[model samples]
Target: MALPESARLEGPILQELLALGGEERLRVLYRRLLAYFPHLDESERDCASARWRTLVQRAGARLVKKGELRREAGRWALTERGRQRAEAEKMLVEPPPEESPRRALSHEELQAMLVEIGRLLGKHAEREHERYDVVWKDSPLSPRLSHVFEVQVHGKLESALAKLKHAYDTQRSKPVLVVSDARDERRAREWLRPYFSGSFHEIG
Candidate 1:
């Protein structure tokens, strides 16, 4: 059974949970909701019950369709517009002022870091080679590729994954996708599972 129709979970409350979690797998978010609303009937809280799950799932889908949330990699996260709404409603939790924010890395810097990592591993690494954003070779003279990286700070996820898939098919190089945030990384991981299968080994 689900919560009473009169006591149904509110959309804003779900958004608040997503904002608080930064990004959360659907199951985890559901569990958090149970904790938040402990007065609900036991039947509604039972994992075996589809009613509660259905309600939550529909609510999440509605938010996604409304452009206020994103469902990626089996996880849900607030979009920029969603965050703004949450903040305006004073539902978002403020971070502690004592902690300083980490500097966001730019696309070029991310590529540079990957190149350095490749070099440290004793492989020759270079940025912006043909269609690939970064690639590693055994040596500058070697024609074979070892690892291929696509740095995606902002752009189509399909485009980046497509290039990696091509590299794997032709060069048999290990494919890696680099993203600025954890959210994108998870999103990439979800997309990789069905399409790339195990061809792509890692996401950083």
Candidate 2:
């Protein structure tokens, strides 16, 4: 079967979820799948779309046929063989950093810079907080957090964006992702394509 971009991504996504979570309901698994591949467009992102849903179902069906996965009653899971395959699959890991002539900021230093920027703006600034790497509040006395910052160094880009999205949804604070290099910035921008509504911002 011809696999489109969504189908291509769904195969590995389903395998990863099944290996990690065991049996998963299709709806919930699909939600996580969308999160993992944020470059998907509108029609592909719509869970209610039959065509999109079929792509996921087809991926599962192929895996089941390969004796790597099983599906029953709207739930999908990996077989023992599938678990091995998933474990064997090479992860999408970040490549080793190239040597730079200029000194680079450490992750903590990046967070500190964000906090310092907030302080200079006269906002209450803090770092290493739960939910965000750095946060800026309206004032020293006010409890309102006005901005949330996440610094991505060599960690999973999706995990960082997930936290930023959560912060935006819960507090309506402006979410910013700070990357260590231009390569990471490009990756972050590609992921934010799904957020055409402009829910996230990237800072170098």
Candidate 3:
């Protein structure tokens, strides 16, 4: 995606926050960057566009300290003052920059895509950070064949799961488990370990 010479991802961050219309945790925001988040740092440092999207996210995050935003519970929101300025400058309502195919999906959209792959007619799999890079096939030959995940790294499970359920309302597989971090991953693993000794597929 083409980031502005100055605001880079920070500009879009501001608009996304406005579109959100309420307080949002940084981790939640980070997850919204998903699949694109982890690679931000290792990208070209000289080029803001080159940096991993997560690095851009961090730059966007710095807006908080800059007094352009507000925070609570480690979450962030558009400050009334910032919102007012954005309204006048028209920064909060700009369209997103063009992006590569993968970059197009928001964090939630990415997760939805992952879960959709689970239901593919034949064997299929996809993976990323919060998970791993691996290849697997959907098969009854495998003992573990249940469970679905939308690899968003943030947001409360209640709303996340609700949105996910709304997307695909079939109980054909295990419920879509929404996790915030590794702790949740461990908890889920421990909880599911006893029942399914088979593979634990991840899509993050």
Candidate 4:
């Protein structure tokens, strides 16, 4: 039987998991998707389960005996035949052509682009500052495409305190940053008094 369009997408999706070494990593990938796309209702998301089963069954039939794919633990890897078929399918696929590319810009042109971007950001910051006194800085965490986390620094204690409180209350996790100076840290602790009543540490 011919594979469905969903099955085709699922084949690559499962292959991506297998290439990452199976279920241990796959579960992490799944969770990251959930965290990033919170709009998805897990209970209503039958696509994942259905696609997973279809990919396993179809790919498994061509590679391993019936039931082999479903029986694996820790990692769900592709059988030899499955791997070959996946490779063949990938070879047959082609990406859509690029829409258009603006003429390559010179150094001066690039600098002009940067200036425009900075102006836009400045306008945005001014608008934001009018509504909220909080100022944010980037976190030390390395950006990962697969991670579902956002980290930021707040200039004032109240903003940081509010975020910290919300994180705990919502059962969500986020990293907050405070100044390295002892005096500033003390002040932050005092401001956070109402919301965060527990011990907090400052890391350089």
C-alpha lDDT (0 to 100) for residue 202 of candidate 1 = 38
Pairs that clash in candidate 3: 25-75, 39-52, 40-52, 40-53, 123-138
Tens digit of per-residue lDDT, candidate 3, span 96-174: 4556554334665655566466657455654441232222336646544245455546555445444334333443334
Estimated TM-score for each candidate:
0.46, 0.43, 0.32, 0.26
Considering only N, C-alpha and C atoms within 3 Å, which residue pairs clash in candidate 2?
none
Per-residue lDDT over 1-204 for candidate 2, one digit per residue giving the tens place of the 0 to 100 score: 222554465456545565557677888766656555555576667666777677777777777888987888987787888777776663642223445687778998998888888888888999977768998989877666688888988788778877877877777778787878755656756765765445444321
Go through the candidates in order and give each one's C-alpha lDDT. Answer: 0.72, 0.71, 0.51, 0.39
Least accurate stretch of 10 residues (summed lDDT) in model 3?
Answer: 128-137
Model 1 CA deviation exceeding 4 Å by range: 1-97, 183-188, 191-204
The RMSD of every model to the true structure, in order and in angstroms, is 16.8, 17.6, 18.2, 17.6
**Most TM-score-accurate candidate:** 1
Local lDDT at 120 for model 1: 98
Stretches > 4 Å off in candidate 2? 1-100, 183-188, 191-204
Provide the global lDDT of candidate 1 against the true structure: 0.72
Top-lDDT structure, candidate number: 1
RMSD of 3: 18.2
Relative to the true structure, candidate 3 reaches a TM of: 0.32
The CA-based lDDT of model 3 is what?
Answer: 0.51
